[model samples]
Target: MSSILRRIFKGKDQQHQIVIIGLDSAGKTTIVNRLLRSEFIPTTRTLGVNYRTVKYRQIMFSLIDLGGQEIYRNLLWQPSLEKADAIVFVLDSADLRISEASKAFWESIQQNENAPVLFIANKIDLPGARTFDTIVQDLDLTRATRSSRPVGLFRISAKTGENFYDAFDWLADVVVGSESVFKCKLRTVILIDLDSHKIWTTKFSSLKNEILDEFNRSISETMHELMKEPAGMEVIIASDLQLVVVKNHPLVVGLIIGYSDSVVRSKLIAERLMNTASSSIEIGEFSSDVLTKLLKRQWPLDIYKSKPRSD
Candidate 1:
């Protein structure tokens, strides 16, 4: 097995492996760079696979950005397949010749009995790009239904950062929920279920207690009138350091806290969260609730929540 595969399969740490594959010039590298928030001019080809680590909502991911050249297609199986928690297949919406390559990559991922896959039709900003409906029909993904089938199909513009977060968030959800099926090492991560309004975190000493206390305090402060309602709380200890809490109907005005090695990085993320909240003035009711929860829990709560005492 390659070193990349070995580390993913044999490592003692909990890290979700996601592979990004598609046809050449399908904007795979562009999407990867956009996700990483880095700027490097496009190169000819990516040898083997390039990897990067990204943290979203306290979930750490090892994203493997694979080359999409025809010569490298055969190298995608075996070692790479052994440890993937999810697969993202990108397609060039404007290039018919390369669309076949995207389908082939999807087929390889389907052969793997691991987690589900996400299909992304990239380069939507291009004029000749195929419509999402056409791509879905041509890929036959709309009719595709397996217990572990592709969870979603997205049309995106990597250059414009459109629909990127939606794709990444979907992958993160699948990775956190797929139990020992992929032989993945459990790590210190948190899973926030928007539908159920719950949060699941890897148990870590006093971390769970600290988080819960903060959450409770914030909810009480933000939704004082709503507290009389029977709020649901489900706590599960998967291991010594993992705690999963399902809090029903999370309050909209609660706090969001995030931890990172550097204070500067945390501050930057906080600023972004503030901007998002400010710009979402007209979002729908459901979206507003979800956004409020994400902002309150995933960003730096210490900087945002400052309300009067609730005596």
Candidate 2:
């Protein structure tokens, strides 16, 4: 099916809304950029909220990027809360003061009582950032546990694109079928589902051969083969395996591999892939468990079900 026809038939029933709120410069924009694998430069603070649509699996999401500054913080309540399927609160782990702010934000968000919240301790790459345990304790979030509404806390570095996928995968599970709230349009992009036995790329085109050849020579022969044929011309290498591609854009593809091999093997592959493509390559890591869930299209409801917030 053509991307256009798929949309025409699927209609708006296939979308959902996810809101990302945090203090100013808490790496909210960085998280979005990492997800899109593109840069979103913000010269000034977010005036109200910025919206972007991302497609994961066969589902599409209308992601609302809300400003975290004090002046704009109040705008995130009520009306916005009414439509949110999930909320991601990004925090600056390097700043102790931000921990207190995160507590306050959580308290405020708790009052809404409708949407689930994911606490993202962002900027883990900073030198002085507190560890995940420290941030959870400092924010007093351990005491704020709930048994009904699922609250998730993750430590991540948006700058280096670490743990961003884990966080999004959680949100994806929560809002999967409930994503119909988003009525916006989306562009044609392929979503790769990484699996243990094979790599699955979904879209409406025949780019699987291209992706397979690209994956084999640079990475592991263990990578085997591409499972499904490409739906669209777009191919996103989604796997827990490490992918080394020359340049950020898909057009500069060379080799994609896993990061688990011996140091010598990994370095040699990286060097070869880089030299072949002659462009900057990016290495992406995925949690094997998350990749499994993505392939099965199953929600990790167990993770969310354990802790519900108390009144």
Candidate 3:
């Protein structure tokens, strides 16, 4: 049972309690099914609670999926929220129940203060899905960030599996308790050579050229606007994307990331990489491979803080 496992691994590093809660038809159980079975199946309304143990990246997760109905909310949510090391709150983005879901979301999260929340705007593949920005405003999620809790809002589709792993990967990183800077999902890393007027960039996720061009223009505009002021780092958050730009002498480094948290830590990472690139090579000299390697070293794969033993 999950209780036995929790007692056995209470203070241990390798196991964590992950609680998933949302209103009915919000795709909470469906997401868990996909993660555990890697396939989708028709799910019925959960009557109470479902428990499963999953091993991801060598870490054990005792996933507690709670029913979204009001009766269960009054009875079962508190205990599970108390034990959760990480919490996932799912919302149906295409459904016209924002007011209801928003109320439910605020109610559930208020029960637990310490658990980091992975706020998922699910059903994004649907034609009627709301934008992430709209959902955030409707839910008033900024209040959570202002509280200084490490919360990440991610858009995902349980049916298409789009951005599915990204949501859980962030949850895993937070549950493992890594540094906030290292937990960021870096989508694109760009370095602008101010002296040579050349741009070198690399992307971790598959991104369209238009998106890249937009980021480039935004970075360039920000750099020029800030050129008159003192040199430093700046974070620009628009919708789901976060742009972190660092200016150090002749080089300006920009990082496009998914999470809105960790602005200070991300600036540190960018400045360190900028310093490395500026000292290691000449302006406009960085090839694609060299730039990719440098960025990877600075923002390595977020999982696995230590290697699994061969035994």
TM-score of each: 0.53, 0.56, 0.57
Q: On a 0 to 100 scale, what is the lDDT of residue 122 in model 2?
A: 86
Tell me how candidate 2 scores on lDDT.
0.53
Q: List ranges where model 3 is wrong by over 4 Å.
A: 1-13, 179-311
Regions of model 2 farther than 4 Å from truth: 1-13, 38-44, 177-207, 214-311
Model 1 Cα lDDT, one tens digit per residue, 76-129: 654676677877888889988744764675676666766677888888879999
Backbone clashes in model 3, listed as residue pairs? none
| lDDT scores in order | 0.54, 0.53, 0.75
Candidate 3 structure quality by residue, lDDT tens digits, 1-311: 59978876764446688999988889989988876765566798888999988755345788999999888887998999988888899999998988888888888888988889999999998999999989889999888777767898899888866666667767766777674334455677888777778778777776566766777777767777656644655555454556777777677788877543444455667778877787655644677688888766666752123242231
Candidate 2, residues 1-311: lDDT per residue as tens digits?
99998887686356777778877878777777656652334445567788888765344778888877776766665467667787788888887675457655666676567677888998887999888887777777775555377787888777654555556656665665354222111111112233222232322223345554554544343222222322111112444223433222222222222221122222233333334322221234433343334423432331132233231
- The lDDT leader among the candidates is 3
After aligning candidate 1 to the native by TM-score, how far in Å is the CA of 147 from where it should be?
A: 4.0
* Model 1 weakest lDDT span, ten residues long: 180-189
Instruction: Count backbone clashes in candidate 1.
Output: 11
Q: Rank the candidates by lDDT, best first.
A: 3, 1, 2
